[model samples]
Target: MSLDAAPGIIAVTLVTVATVAIGTWGLRFSRTTSDFFVASRTVHPRLNASAIGGEYLSAASFLGIAGLVLTFGAEMLWYPIGWTAGYLVLLVLVAAPLRRSGAYTLPDFAEARLGSRAIRLLCSLLVVAIGWLYLMPQFQGAGITLHAVAGAPTWTGPLIVGAVVLVNVMSGGMRSITFVQAFQYWLKLTALLLPAAVLLIVWAGEGRPRPDVDAAWSLPLADGGGIGLYTTYSLILATFLGTMGLPHVVVRFYTNPDGRAARQTTLTVLALLGVFYLIPPVYGALGRVHTAELASADALVLELPRLMLPGPLGDVLTGLVVAGAFAAFLSTSSGLTIALAGVLSQDLVAKLPQHRLSGVAAFRLASVVAVAIPCIAAVAVPHVSIARAVGLAFAVAASTFCPLLLLGIWWRRLTDVGAAAGLMIGFVGSGGAVVWTLSGGSEPPLLDALLAQPAAWSVPLAFAAMVLGSLCTPRRVPAHTSRLLVRLHTPESVPLDRG
Candidate 1:
């Protein structure tokens, strides 16, 4: 191998071996189906928090945010800010209530809250859709990272990640993945932090030269006038509201010991994410000063050390980043696979009478479905910026699940019929916009912009649909909603006949 290829190859090999090793170690603890699905609800708060941070910090955080920061300047910081703050929203609003509900997946929560199998089915499909959408970008980022580091074919990256994640998931399920993902959070943090520190030192030694970009690059909402402003706020809404709805994220809460543990995990995740996010923007700012001529802004972090230092040190930094990038792909892909697989096993695979799949068998089969579709789609679909694709996933999630979760937990008047209607309306509205945008049909500038970032409008429309529909059918509200609300809001320590 050439100088460029050897370090990348070594780093990737080590990361892969380490990941499989950690996963195998976790296998000993994963005996029952509950263990496979939620580690039997026994994971400690700190470890669970680390795993949540690992899985939640996807390709978008590792690669896409810096690219956006480089391209659009301060406005793009909203990506990371909204992402971290979303956990705050989860901490205060969703986490404890969700854990108290005792649902393994979003679909489980939907069914438990609304008492409707049809709604459960709809939530399952949405979970699958959002997981696939989110997974596609991780795979794409993998392709980009591998190509940058090792000069490999694009398809190889996604294929390698998909296969590794599938094996980790199938062998030991969530129990195994929990350990692997926790390790990855520290790995990713180390990967980004070391290079950023060295690069900042290098930048200072070179006399603190500023980027030669124009004034507009430093200003928020300076480009494209009204559309820029609209896009920024819409992105904010999507990410802030959307994080709670993500299937992979919600699945992690199920592993907590109880509602209080879930709350603690969310709080710790906010801290982990806050520290990790600070490093990416450093790459973006430094890239402008030193390496503006690179082909892709997304590659700026990987290329910066090499561009600035240009020898053994740069090469080593590249290797570390390559490992971190791959870790990002692996961790996020594993989490999504686990979440989607759970839904598939419970709602799809086991529902087939003739399949006769046992607990592990159904989950393994569902793992295949969860991993394969997105891997294929990643290759088939034209590559958008990884961050943009992730943002779209957030948009769909905010439109569909955010309203369902908020109203379901907080409102007694939220009827099953209303929830189903809201979900369908959100799905159709946001899903249609996603299809329209991805199909390469942007027109009538205003309409195109609205479709491109539909969250600001779609979210409210879904809420409105739910509220109005609930009012129209007030008699259909679940009789036990009040009691369930008490269970959700009350302290777990409080003695009551919850049953």
Candidate 2:
């Protein structure tokens, strides 16, 4: 199972260089605060969609999905299924209205919709919290990838990725990284797509053996009759509903020119994600047949190429996957860093004395801090299943922001008090579950499952809180709610004051 490291090292180096080169080149187009924040909101559908795909296809998509499928079998497919369908949820319920809100960040949206600085501050806190939770796994995955690629130490990967992302995000902000990330999306696609094609040909030549699937692994839902169904549905709920709430993902909609462009971008992202997701399952199936005994399932994609091909050809393919893996870490990490930096810098600009720093300078400072915390955490904390770690973050987002976004946009009755109540309840409930699981506490089976996968209970609870709180304080609803709803739902052709 051992292989040469030169090819992987080269592949990773090239990807890193290309990412930095593309991002640096994009600096030419970035001049103002708008450019740094949202690419001046002029990105068209195709490009914005590509950037979103690049950012959205984290290590979870590139490596973790295949690993999960290899280890857990059919039931894990719900992750990608739910993740992709989440955008459809986003398209129907959120995209246009969110863009119409004309907010720079989710917190901005909350503040505007509720007309409360208090709610905005609360949203900002959750954004940073979720961003850190999501970003940590990326650093962890980088450590795993580099370790798989060249037997590098685990700590080295996070530091390298953190340094690279800090440079990229600090250089030109979202405008710069959008170009870099869009290019990475295609690289990631090619990384898995071509390798799968070659592997299938070899697989066909070798008589097309079926994957070794036991009865339990073959089930669509997992094991444990009632419990498995609950876990599967809980996972589906988290991934599907969580996509809209991810700060890195949600902020990209702000990069589009208008609501129509946002919708178009989402459609494009759906198509791109659909294509990319098809490849991981192929790797998983092949893993079952070829490299079933590998020590770490996370390295299944990396090792499978060499195990089957066994020559210069194998090394080349492994290198390509390595490139894709690094791209996954950089693109997603860059996006998360940009998102967190945006929220942090805005806080600085609003709260700090204006003469101390300008927006861009404030952003640079924030980017360093945003990247540093999780980078340190990745090194200090023991690595967990990369996919599971990401899912927990999604569960947190689903429970919290899912309610806020849905209720804020559709239910004009959503008052600040209600929004605040919902967010706190959601955050504490899901975040507590995450901490409990992470801290390695487990006893009763039902209780373990409930805390491990909190979305099922937490999401409904948050939604209920928001609804009840809003109903109880009816007069607290903003006076401008009706006009804002009209603007949010109205066609751009009508030419109302979008301001």
Candidate 3:
């Protein structure tokens, strides 16, 4: 069934215009740099939760997961479950402390906790790397969605979303984006859910045909299964820990009023994500019954509407799905760009004495730099799977910032030398894997295993390196560990000066 481009294009264009308008209106309330950066640290938990859900549920959650379910069967459900469950880990372990640290970026947190500019610099590089890796998939998904629905050139989608995201992010920073994302989260959920319900009913009315469960559901780690298992485990590790390390996700914590509020935000995010995740698997399972083509799996969510319900209803629904797919791209990319821009502004562009840039000017400049690089990469290398590229981003996040944040916040013995050593090991290990994969080099079995699932080993290796490095140079441990710990865990109600 071919999608007519006219209606879908109109619907997506309208939605994009409305989203930007609303974001621009949101800027009226954003008067200060603090407002732009953290909404003056006053965003309510419910709204923040929705924004988090919006930002977290990127192309992977919206389109890729359903596609995976269509192509790979029940095992693919683990991706969504792991993605949502990672929030539980974040809530239990990191959220509040991270919020209480009062850092704008991950590097800010690192420098605050470790008291090391060098460590902050290292963390900055990782933040940009992870953000770019994650951003590529969002752009790619945009291109795919536009090509599917609008019949436009594939690059059009990424270009459109990239422009919209830059406009929204540069206009108001976190202040405008928080509201925009919260709204988009509901828009995306409705776009997917309404069509899902209609399609399910249509499928039921036409006489329910069971999916080819036997062919797709078989599971055993043999007959070329070892590679799948290895990749799966690596993916699991990446998503499990990557949430904590993502600069965009971490930056959201800073928007909370306090550590406790950050924890509460995470809990709400978990519930929102859990509810949203249930819808995608339905699309996947239904796609299995309706459209079995492997290449069509990526278009499963967008195509299901037309397949089940033909004529005007299907076109409208398809248009809505197209708009939501664009939302997935725009919201996620906006958050990622914001995070990347913040780091680049602080670490790279801010170094010039004459520049003295601060607030919106700094953010806008960084946004341009942040968006341009990934935009080019998305266009230049459009063949990578959205989910796989996103997973690589997560792997990089897991290998680098995960160790730094975990140890920086909790381990008093963490030293600058140790942190630097860990960052170097993780960067080399995960970066090498990514480069090798991109290079298309013939890798040995063990090397391939290491490259694909480096987190399982690389993370441990980083931790060990950091610990050993620290022990060898105990003098490098910050002298203010106790004071910093006290500040991090203390309730926000307590005034620091009074204490």
- Writing each residue's lDDT as its tens digit, candidate 3 over 205-316 gives 8798887677546452211366667766777777898778888999999888888888888999999998899999899888878764544467788888877777999998
Model 3: residues with Cα > 4 Å off, grouped in runs: 1-3, 215-228, 292-296, 439-449, 494-499
Q: Lowest summed lDDT over 10 consecutive residues: which window, candidate 3?
A: 215-224
- Which numbered prediction scores highest in TM-score against the true structure? 1
Q: Rate the local accuracy (lDDT) of all candidates.
A: 0.91, 0.91, 0.83
Task: Give all candidate RMSDs, comma-separated.
Answer: 1.0, 1.5, 2.2
lDDT (Cα, tens digit) per residue for candidate 2, span 1-499: 2449888899989999999999999998899988999999989899999999999999999999999999999898888998899999999999999998889999999988899988988999999999999999999999988888888989999999999999999898999999999999999999999888999999999999998888877677967789878988898999999999999999999988888888999999999999888889999999989855765788888888999999999999999999999999999999999999999989754367656887888898899989999999998887778889999999999999999999988887999888888999999999999999988858887898889899999999999999999999999999989888987888777978654
TM-scores, all models, native as reference: 0.98, 0.98, 0.95
Q: What is candidate 3's local distance difference test score?
A: 0.83
* Residue-level lDDT tens digits of model 1 in 1-499: 5678887889899999999999999998999999999999989999999999999888889999888888888888888999998899989999999999988999999988989999999999999999998999899888888888878889998999999999899999999999999999999999999999999999999999998688888886636789878888898999999999999999999889889989899999999999999899898899889755766677878888898988999999989988898899999999999999999999999979877989899999999999999999999998888888898999999999999999999999999889988989998999898888877856787798889889989999999999999999999998888878988888889997664
Candidate 2 lands at a TM-score of 0.98
Tell me model 1's lDDT, rounded to 2 decimals: 0.91
